[model samples]
Target: MVPDAILQEDGPLRPNLVTVAHAQYRVRAGALSVVTETVALTKALGRVLAQDVTATRDQPPFKASAMDGYAVRSQDLARRVNPATLKLVGESQAGRAFTGRVSRGQAVRIFTGAAVPAGCDAVVVQENTLAGEGTVTILSDGLKLTRRHVRPTGQDFNCGDVLLKSGERLDPWRLSLVAAAGLDRVTVARRPVIAVLSTGDELVAPGEIPSGDQIFESASHAVMALIKQWGGKPVSLGVGKDTKKSLLRALKTADAELIVTIGGASVGDHDLVKPALAKLGLELSFDGIKVRPGKPTAFGNLKDGRRVLSLPGNPASAFVMAQVLLKAWLETSLGMPPRQDYAHATTTAAIGANGPREAFLRGTCSLSSDGRMQVTPFADQDSSLITVFSRTDALIHLPSGSEAKSPGDLVDILPLDRL
Candidate 1:
């Protein structure tokens, strides 16, 4: 039997004993190993860009009016003339331009987005003008503000200018910007397909009636939901039995960029995940982490280069581990920078010292009477308490070897769900 390699606080670092930081580094290092693909701008939302996108043409392409007004030469307004009245020579509407030039004492009736007529330098907003038959009167000398109500050529972006850098995720606004930049198709990182697998013969499908000794499978679904939320494509691979044969078959058949298995990662006799994976040429990176509620979490790569992360069977443990580890891995694969939402707050209640393993206690985060952020850890921290986990909005992190904390002690908390 292979000895379980656990990372304890006081012990020296071992190759097989992984700290959360070390595991995160491994995931980030391999994140850019995925392939890239070109996608239409219409379908690029939530996809990470694989290349810097530059503007193909200048925005506006030409000096254009920003308001429904008359385009006049600034010199026409500065002339030592009375009332500054200028004849309306022609009209310039959107999509159509006044081909004739505007000489002194002449203005073109232009609408918003209309190209500015040649020889014109500014626009007189209709609000500041009095319209008359064949002529207009400037009320406040709008031309004094240079290029007033005119969007200059390349005002928004210039041709060949880099509008977005590589590794930025495309959102609705970014997509709109890219479209405006004259790109119909964009190159982006291929969305990583993650296969979520739940193990244990004692677990049954969610809608099915469980036997006397069985529990409903849940963590895998939650994992899949999270993957989808994070811009990944999640494929569910159902439940794996306890036997090595079943587990091995499941691992071999999954055609995914990453495989996440829930359950059977500990040292119990029936915990056959490690042994089964070994039989299939699995190279273990870290068999265990130094964190509570997820100490049994394991990560490795298959011989074919697909990464595998195995989580404990308990619902709360599996969910927390996925949020901490799997989320980071997915972000890295998607060409996004690794990020976590952590908030520091004072504890509202006294807390005992943590054990050797780093502890992440589920808790509620709220504002105190003085408007300071505060967190209250629940009394029970059992890994099986799925209900408590569901209601928690934060994970109060207690590092290994931490001493008892008082009510006002500051703590780091990872925000969960919507904050």
Candidate 2:
């Protein structure tokens, strides 16, 4: 039987309260899924690959010399005299190969990366040979005598071989590899456009004079920076006044794959984000995650298939929610696997038992005198304290209903920079 909730045209108007994990799972589904586009190699850095890249041409394309030496036949340097002398025909430098074939008792002066001329199967290093006018002497036949110093054609990779798989981030090393594969461009996933919105009548743009009750709007700026760092293009929609009509008007300009609004998401009388979005045909997935500093966090979808994330109004809360929740959603939307950067560290002080909601406390992470990582959480954990948030290098995560822990207890920490 179809639930009445599902039968509704715009789905549930009320936001469902859920655990943080469940909220994350629902938010990771279709928001900002991978979109592919061709991009020049010069602009491909930091972009995720959308297709399996194959080598267009063989690396090294031909048999090349691996050392600055004389190219000779194995048979000519076989067990003969102590120093076998051969006639030096011509030189083979990189980008210029010796045209003539090397006959018996004849050697070519080949530099590193130079294609080995025909009839030569070995490269005697320059240090292992004596070179004079039109003649060369092989002094070392000490080891096995095959084509040991020649880099065969297609040595690193062969033509048509898959060099990079889809969904791989392009770093400097991978970009170099792509260039070596004779490709001038690559197909990569399009960066998702993220729209950041800050809501509240008390908020004003930064650098503007704030009255006694007004504060500078900040949450959207931080969120935008985070989105850019996480490989998404962010557009700030500025502050939406704390009124249903004003919010609805501001939201009309938010045309993006994911829209993140800061503040006015809770159940307060002035918290009008839910009603505003609900009236605009938003299908509520979940709201009110069970987490500290961000319990009012909400996630849903607009009528046009755009995802909406409503964060807490406080600066610290907004930052933490962005890291813990928005980061995962962005990764999923980009088609990348989830990566947790949590590390274990010993606490330097005692922490009280957690309530029903999970807690993420801002803390300073530093190396102790003994070279072990130590975490010390701040005494004041107020969500509005941006100064405390700035000083902290990591978040100390305590599970729901955890017992009071003393100093030296191991705890999980999520590094601030990783977010």
Clashing pairs in 1: none
Score each candidate by Cα lDDT.
0.84, 0.84
lDDT of 2 by residue, 1-419 (tens): 11222112222223455776787788786467678899999999888888988988889899999989988888987767688888999999999999999998899999999999999888988888887778987875522456768999999999989999987889899999999987889998789998988998898998999999999987787789989888789998888999898999878778888889999998899999889888778887876777776878888888878889989999988999899889888877777777767899999988877666677888998898999999998887878998888798999988777777788899999998644
Model 1, span 209-261: residue lDDT tens: 99999999889888999888777899988999999999999988999988999
* Span of ten consecutive residues with least summed lDDT in model 2: 1-10
Clashes of each: 0, 0
State how far residue 354 of model 2 sits from its true place (Å).
Answer: 3.5
Q: What lDDT score goes with residue 278 in model 1?
A: 88
Residue 379 in candidate 2 has what lDDT?
80
